[model samples]
Target: MVAREKLNQLKEKFGGAVQRADMPCNERLFVFVEASALKAVCQYLFRDLDARYVISIGMDDRPFSGKFMVAHDFAFDQDHLLCSVLTHLPADNPKVDSISDVVPAANWAEREIRDLVGIEPVGHRYLKRLVLPDGWPDGVHPLRKDFAWNQVPEGYDDTREFKFDEPPEGCTVVPFGPFHPTLDEPAHFRLYIEGEMVRGCEYRGFMVHRGIEKLAESVLTYNEIPMMAERICGICGCVHNVAYAQAVESAAAIKPPPRAEYIRTIMLEIERLHSHLLWVGLACHIVGFDTLFMQSWRIREPLMWIAEKISGNRKTYALCVIGGVRWDITAEVKGELRKVLDKLESEWTPVVAAVSKDKNIQKRTRGIGVADRALVKNAGLVGPVARSAGVNMDCRRDHPYAAYDRLDFDVITENGCDVWSRVLVRAKEVFESIKIIRQCLEKMEDGPLQLTIKDELPVGRIGLSSVEAPRGESHHFVITGENNRPRRWRVRAPTYQNLQAIPAMIKDQQLADMTISLGSIDPCFSCTDRMETIDLKSGATKVWTQEELLKLTRTKKT
Candidate 1:
């Protein structure tokens, strides 16, 4: 929300500590704040300056600093724009005072830092093990450069210590996922059902902790890492890849040409459209509306076809490179994309009307999974989930990235703050994405897509890139130079942050509605692949390991 001029004023206020400010096609000013003032600066941004804390990224330092560095990113709604205020924290004894006091949403990001980087955000009320097992070693942060692979430290234990137990009276807790019949991604949730009503809930995940950051530091070059990181989340492939590429470009102080920008935007919107359509199908399934679900996915096939034709893969498109993009949209390809768009635009009205008027859908999703605006804001919800709850926050419209500034679209908002509203927001966004794509097609001109750059990048360089993925904002941080590969890279999938609000939204809803509500969040468990069962009355917990379950099932079969 910070204007160009106001950002300049803020930069002037900080002077030297504010290193290398650039607005990057997006309205956001990538300001590198000094470590000393991170907490205070975040407080100022949230309280007096209208910005709210989004999330944090921790990365390894290359030459200038120590083993790692951290950036606490913030966004605001002053002019309904998404701008960032980044604070850099040194890796040695990397400690920054927690801003949860000013911005409650910092809690999960702080927990992530605790789990992955071993950096303690001082004053975080609940800094227990999150995303990692409790028995995981203290100093062996997975995101750090020093973490040893293929070997556990001496005397290290594999067991985790769970903190919660025992549901309240009248509450019947149901443990759904790390793996579930309905879920496509792995994440665990304990739903407290009071009869049919959900009194409260708890979330636990991160089973698929592949050490992507550490892996990027170890094996891949800068150009290669984007392809590698794109696999971080199967659904949001373009988001992660594009953000990572942008981060590296920023660190290297290079900009992709105008043609590349337009291509990136087109890809981004196409991905967004595809993701939302998939969510629509999932939501319909949750309500047992198979016909609608089939229709939604059937409509979605063309989008996937386009992704395959353009990027050569349906899921993990290796389309992005460090300097810019790996491929360009040709005249024939552009014409084909336009044809697909025309089909999509024509279907929009009928789909929206059918979803809106369906009595069965109304019965299940109308008032289910309601979360208060304050609750959502405090949890730091992002993307469609936040916007559905009347948050009025969209990283694309608020933070103009790629070709967003040159293109036009509305930041769709819904004040309903319920499952139905969230569905509506996504449905509306499908139209807006089509609108943006049409504009891009109309205005796109011929030029070079990827700019040529030297193999070696500048040393001690750091860059941050955030794009509005289908679900929400996907953030990437790159740390490395001369090597043209990041010494350390942090990838924050939107599901990493938005999962916090799942508990808040499903509370007091019915057991069946809980299923519907879960679908509303459009979950992608980027780090986790499984679930844990907890005692409803006593909170006693037990993780049903996959191998154990398989063994038990085999014995029964025998």
Candidate 2:
């Protein structure tokens, strides 16, 4: 009943117009609807059914189907259902009604599709450049099949600066970045400032949009993309790696061994531990509490050692392969891991207590950067950003992946809906990560680490996976193709959605507090710059150590 009940409802509502449908599992549905009725169906699914909008994907289906494809993904969190309503329009008239009005979270997605795939979203309120760089040529959609990954078309203009919308009445302009001290990546934000208060802001980002999806679609093999995916972000590299591997596994119907699942879980949680610590310390540093920042990094240094000992690296462990994990936890490493967890827990408990009660930290963060429940729904923000706002949605629990279904950690949420609550949520989640790793260790069973597949993966099979990254949910979609590559690979980084909510979060807030506000979301511009989905293969990487970062911070302050 869980499988077909909702699919039946969609069929019953749309009748003959609901052209075709497929169910990948009991919890996932793919329905093909007529392009003309897409907006109506989207409204029905989003408003009437109360489904949460996930992401929208546009593809050039002309090579195969002589039409353009649009997929609006949604998750029914309560029902444990993930659905994609796919519609195809004729190549000559590639236009579909926009559902941004009905589901506000779909706004950036709609514009993104328009930018990359050349499909127009009719009635879109602001169809500005969302993904492409400032000087990209018009009518040259990069995601189209004919466009080569390395091709720069004729008539390209590299110096055409983006003209942002006019400021509100009596508001002075304050440019934040296309380079910021707090951000490791570049994104330009023009703030409409009235004295010290911010009235509005316009974002012009995607400065580093790399054609990774095109690379995957054109070049890489099935098992080789996991390493590339890890390059999405230094912080949540494993999340993307795991998400990409799981997507391929889903498409090929491959289930890794139980021990491999446990190993994957361990690596993911290890990443969460380091990433949360990094975020908390940065949040403190942003609020002028550099002492805590240094202290947190001091406590976090050992995890790097533990990770290097296990995976031969401090970060980008390259732990994921197509069917299973690349590394295993040995008895000696398990002993060391247990000791590390013990020390992490003991050292972290007091710090959590101190931050929770500290007046300066509380005053600096408590009411700044608020994202209420309404904004969470409208912007599709995930992870700590949404959870702190009383939105109890965790991909590990709601849409279980890897060994998460076998784990018993709680999804930490708070009702404060501010930077303070976000701090509490992440700080508490470190313990939860510790608990999950401990459980994985205890439940370990000696077995093979990966599956042996005798045949190539089937062509044209579709797969999708969502992993809970430290910042939020990192989602990947894949369509298997010939030459051992994906036909279309789409990535929706959590930052893409969460960053869109920044304008709303900072509105009417003090200009002085904006950095902490942005820092609270743990914005990873490199992750957001992932223009399309690409499977990342595990490989060598260079990561910033705590000492290096500390020196950099001190240098900046001086």
Candidate 3:
């Protein structure tokens, strides 16, 4: 009765879009709310009930409903796992109110949503395209159901003629990517700066939109989509696959064997280790520590090798499938993992010590993008970014899935709430992940890795699954019970949550600090791009194009 009362309060406060509520196999109950109530519920969950923002995601809902869904994963005590606040908005309109006002971490999430899903966040102070080309079409949202796969929009082939030289008066706009020098991927950013500080910004992406969501609907079966989804992000591929499979399983109401759960957790932690290592390297590079970046990546080689050895592919390992995992680590591989963990533990000490003690790194990172605790909670941030801001949230610890509940590790947090704190949190989490892998190795029991789930999905059922990705939270929403595949599939990556907090973080920071501040969110632009609009009423124009405006000063010497 006492437990029920607590759950009831949560339901009462955030009820409108609460879709499905359930206790896990354990007795603790959690309710799923709408994305509209995300900020309110997160506040209720945290300030009032002491819950934490575990993670959030924005998924592409293709075909059937043709809507994009936002899922915010939250948690309370160790026992209770709040499923998510799941809300769906039209793929055409795509826009939703920005939650950054409430949770600072959401800045990046909103940016990515604009970048990938073409969602125009109403009132989002920094609604720039994050990951796509500079001259993407105005009304063609990429993740929408109707976006043509084979044909590129007419003007996309020749966007070189549409560059803008100077931004409007008092609004300092600077273009970022879509093939600039900053990043490997084709994500673009146009910063609106006020002197040395950033006033607001925009992000663009989707230069390489493979139409994975649309392809998933046409080509893949329910079982095959898991492997297909694994290719979404090369770094966090496994999490995408696992979360999608789990969502399918939840919709079907089928649980994998206990041993399979243990194996899944092991893979997840291994992936976590490699991801953190990769990010550490990137973080180093961002601060001009190329040697450290290379060294960290070198250490990550063993984990990648092990992943290939076990799952056949080095990057996109199709280890996870619906109903169960596709591969299992043999005793030999298990032994090798333990050896790798031991090696990483020994090697990481000096590496981390070097970074932590470096005066240069300290100068570059310390106090450089501070998001206070109030901003964090209000924005409802997630993952290490939130943890760095004193939000002790980790999906593995809070909303335990797979064998996370069985494993033991602390959710690392730091009060520093700066770029330095974020780096520290991720570094500590790598160690915690190592501990988890060791536990899984010791406790492994021989069992079948695969389960036979029917190809067809049942009708009228919706299942949401959330996983802590390297950046933050990745969510999969499956609304399909009929036919061979999901009728509606929505996938939300962590960038969706982190993108929202950018404007808040970069407001007063120097322009140079903008790079580091953006990196603090740990964004992924696998598929994001710029989108522009012209205000019909005012006749003032806002268009995202690379078109070069005529410079009056550069005009013929009159």
lDDT of 1 by residue, 1-558 (tens): 345765666666666756656665444466667777667767776766757566676654524465456677766644644445555566467787787777887777777777676777888987767766655656766555565544455545545456665788887778988678788866678877777777887777766666666656766677778777777778888888888888787777788888788888989889889988888888988888888788888888899999898888787878778657777788898889999988987876798887798888878888787766677667767788778877877767665667888987898889887888888999899999999988988888778878888557876565667789898887776666445566656666777666777777777666777777777878777632211111122222334465577788889554
- Model 1: residues with Cα > 4 Å off, grouped in runs: 1-37, 59-69, 77-94, 149-151, 159-163, 527-558
Tens-place lDDT digits, model 2, residues 1-558 = 564888788888888879988887887788899988889898998889988888999988888888889999888888877888999889885898999998899998899889889999999999998887666778988899988877777766656778889998999999999798887789888999999999999998887766777788877887788888888788889999999999888887899999999999999999999999988999998889999899999888999999999899999999988898888899999999999999999999999988899998999899999999999988888999999999999999988988999989999999999999999999999999999999999998899999997898988777878899999999888888888888888888899899999999999999988898998999998888886332222223323465577788789554
- Residue range with the least summed lDDT across 10 consecutive positions in model 3: 529-538
Give one digit per residue, the lDDT tens place, for model 3 in 146-176. Answer: 5643446655533333354355469777766
Worst 10 residues of 2 by lDDT: 533-542
Per-prediction TM-score, please? 0.86, 0.94, 0.77
Best candidate, lDDT-wise? Answer: 2
- Each model's C-alpha lDDT? 0.73, 0.88, 0.70
Error of 1 at 122 (Å): 2.5
The true-versus-predicted C-alpha distance at residue 187 of model 2, in Å, is 1.0
Under the 3 Å rule for N, CA and C atoms, how many clashes does model 3 have?
56
lDDT score of residue 479 within candidate 2: 80
Model 3 misses residue 512 by how many Å? 2.3
